[model samples]
Target: MRYLFSFIGLVYSSLIKLAVLFNPKARMMERGRWKVWGKLRGGIVPGGRHIWFHAASLGEFEQGRPMMERIRAEYPDYRIVLTFFSPSGYEVRKNYEGADVIVYLPADRISRVRKFLDLVQPEMAIFIKYDFWPCFLLELERRQIPTYLVSSIFRPTQLFFRWYGGAYKRLLHCFTHIFVQDEASRILLGKHGIDPVTVAGDTRFDRVISVYEARKSLPLVERFAATVPEDGLVIVGGSSWPPDEEILVRYFNRNPKVKLILAPHEIDKEHLLQIISHLRRPFIRLSEATESNIDRQDCLIVDSFGLLSSIYRYGQVAFIGGGFGKGIHNTPEAAVYGVPVIFGPRYEKFKEARELIAEGGAFTVSSAEEFTSLIERLISDKGYREAASRAAADYIRTHAGATERIVRQIIR
Candidate 1:
């Protein structure tokens, strides 16, 4: 099984190399890894015991960020090496102040894994959510490093639970301990004989709480809110795709009592123009808005990054995008602001989205009619909206403490 795994890694590396020729994302990942050795050898890790944290992408990075920040503040003896398996995480947070070293994780092969572990020599390893690289994890186990898997959720359909998943089942043993998001994950892992698993909830709940507490104030967003009529509501469509925008904008054009604010997933000129073309109402780009002119705009287009999280606080409702496409963006980010959230009809995988729906705090729509009816009800019925808002807020409050749980257990 081990030899077969090595052969599979070789093929995977070869395929990635070939993919770099045609896929821009693959090229970015390849380019990012090219400097990994240089970064490791060039004294990126400071002199201290090292604690390594691995995340697969931007989503996983966020799930693990609160842990990094917590450990950095609480334990001064350990240097943090944060590695990302995908370019989306590394490129966006290369200069993050929480970690001593930030670099792309090398490909999962014996030689590369050995070199990586040798260079950093982490005393502890933390894998957030998913992205279990076999070779690297096995090597860390061999070294007797205190390794952990946090915010993990296991399903019976995964390879580890399959009859043919002997190798994958062994990979789960590499972790010193596993902290899962829910009791179901804990029960599933225990049924597989994976011991020392704790139900610590999802750390992202804690992360979003911190975000809500410390979210920055945007003058531009506040000014735009002032432009809205007191009887009207602002609908913040965050990380929106064309599919999401089509439904949202179509309803906004017909409705006079609601203002729409769109923060698209991609703010590239082409996508921005597509969003603008759909808007029949007077819309203004956030960058171009002013106190004098902001009043004239019915739709506020967020052409900037880092403000969507903060801007959610100003809206009466939130439309988390990408559900009609890849999935939903962070629903809790908006839900933390005590707003009713709506998204497209593709949110089966997200546990929080499912929970929010069950709790009657979130809604999903497949078309413009569904959205219009849902939003209109939430808008007109003040009691219903407030009840939904409280549900959203309560969900966030209860699910928190994962960071404190995981971090205290690891550091203490």
Candidate 2:
């Protein structure tokens, strides 16, 4: 099984290298890991209590962030080592002040893993969400390192529970403890005879709440907020994709009275222009908007990053993008601010989105008609909107404290 897995990893790495010729992201992944051992050897400080955290991408990084911050605060002596499997996360947070060292995780081969373990000698290993590399887990276990999986969710369909999943199931045993997001995951792990599991909820709830409380003021967002009449609505389309923008553009065309803030997942010039071409209303890029003339535009197009979470404050309703594609983006970011959330129908994979929908805090739309109807109802009916807002806010308040729980267990 180990040999087979190693062969698979080699094939995957070679494919990524080949992909670098045409794919920019693939190029980043390749370039980021070029001479990665030297980077790791140089960055890691010697003779200190080292704690390592691994996240696959930006979403997992956010899920693991609160715990990372808490560990830094509580265990000041420990040097933090953060690793990302994807360039999307590493490129964005490579200079993060929270970690003592940040590096791209080397490909999970026996030799590479051994070298990495020898270099860092982490006192503890923490994998956020689900990016379990079999070789890495096996090597960590061989060294008897205390490893943990945090904010984890498991489904029955995963190979670990399958009849032919003996090799994959061994990966779960490597973890000293598994902190899951829900009871179903706990039960599932228990069914597999994996003991020492705890249902700690999702740490993202705590992170988003903190972000909402400590959100900074954006002058452009505030100016855009002021553009809408007192009774008018400001619909925030956050982390939106082209499909999401199409539905939003249709809605905007039909209802020009409502203002919009469009923040796409990608901020490329072509994507931004594609969105602008579809819109019938007067819109301005966030960079171009000023305090004096910001209110004159009907739409505010965000062509930059890092403001989507904070921008939820100015919205009465939020439409989180990516639901129409892979999955839904963060719903709790907007839900934490007491705004009703609406997203595409492909959100079942996200626990928060499903729970919000069940709690009446969020609505999912399968088509433009469903989206239009939901938006209209939320805007026109104050009572209905307020109920959804309250539900969303309450859900966030209740789901918080997961970080605290997980941190307490880890520190113990």
Candidate 3:
């Protein structure tokens, strides 16, 4: 089984490398790995008593962030080394404040894992959410390193739960503890004989709330936000996938008076062109627009990075994307801004999405017809929008502090 897994990994790796040659994100991937090498060789990592955190991408980083901050405050002497499996997360957060070092996890091979462990010499490692690298995890287990999986959730359909996944299921036991997002995940892990599981909710709630708290004093955001008409409505589509943008563009065209801000998940030329072509109204790319150009267009297509969270503050209705595909993007980000969120139907895996819907803070549509109708009603009716917005904010407030909970258990 291990050999088969290794063979599959190699094939997947080759395909990824080929894909990178044609993708703009390829540069970010190579740059991140190079950055990691530079940090390691330059002696940037603090030598003694280090804590390691591994996240697959940007969302996972947010899932791990609250715990990262807590670690910094509680164990001031211990250094933080954050590693990423994908370029998206590392490239965006390479210069993150709390971490002493941010780097790419070496490819999951025995030799690479051994070398990394020798150099980093971490006292403990935190695997945020679903990034489980077999060889690296095996190395950590062999070394008796205290490793944990935080904000984890295991579904019945996961590879580990299958009859062919006995070997992978054994790997779950490598963790010193598993802090899952729900009771179902806890039950699944227990069925596999992996104990020491705790229901730690999700750390993303804490991360988003912190984003809102920090936004209170940012001068640039205030200046940019002032350009928005004081009485006009704000609709923010954040981390929007292509399909989500298509849905939004059609909706926006039907109501030209509404103010809309779109921050697509990928800012590449291909996607930018897709977004531009779908819009019927006069729209301005954020990069091309000046402060003087604010009122010149009804739609502002954000082609920038790092401002999506702050832009949410100006939103009365928020649409978080990626739900139409595998899952949804961060709901807490929009909820933090106190807005009603609407997305597509593939949200079964996102616990927060289900909870928010149950609380009347979010709505999920299985088709374009459903999404269009819900969005129109929300936009037209003031009372309905306001009620949903308040509910969204309340849902977020109730879910905060998963980070502290997980950290307390892990440190113990």
Q: How close is candidate 3 to the true structure, as a TM-score?
A: 0.92
In candidate 3, position 355 carries an lDDT of 88
| Candidate 1 residue spans exceeding 4 A from truth | 44-47
Q: Compared with the true structure, what per-residue lDDT tens digits does model 3 show for residues 88-167? A: 88778988998988888776656556777888899999999997888778778989999999988889999999999888
- Please give the distance, in angstroms, between residue 274's alpha carbon in candidate 3 and its true position after superposition: 2.7
Ranking by TM-score: 2, 1, 3
**Which pairs clash inside model 3?**
none
- lDDT against the true structure, per candidate, is 0.89, 0.90, 0.82
lDDT of 2 by residue, 1-412 (tens): 7767777788888999999999999999888898577777887888878999999999999999999999899889888999999988999898899998898888887777888989999999999999999888988898999999999999999999889998899899999999999999999999899979999999999899889989989987887887687777999999999999999988887786789999999988888888888888888999888877787899899888788999999999999999899999989999999999999989887888999999999999999999888887887899999999999999999999989998898877
**Arranged by lDDT, best first:** 2, 1, 3
Q: Whole-model lDDT for model 2 versus the true structure? A: 0.90
TM-scores vs. true structure, each candidate: 0.95, 0.98, 0.92
Better of 1 and 3 by lDDT: 1
**Lowest summed lDDT window (length 10), candidate 2:** 223-232
Q: Give one digit per residue, the lDDT tens place, for model 1 in 179-220.
A: 998888999999889989999999998888999999998887
RMSD of 3: 2.5
Sequence-dependent TM-score of model 1: 0.95
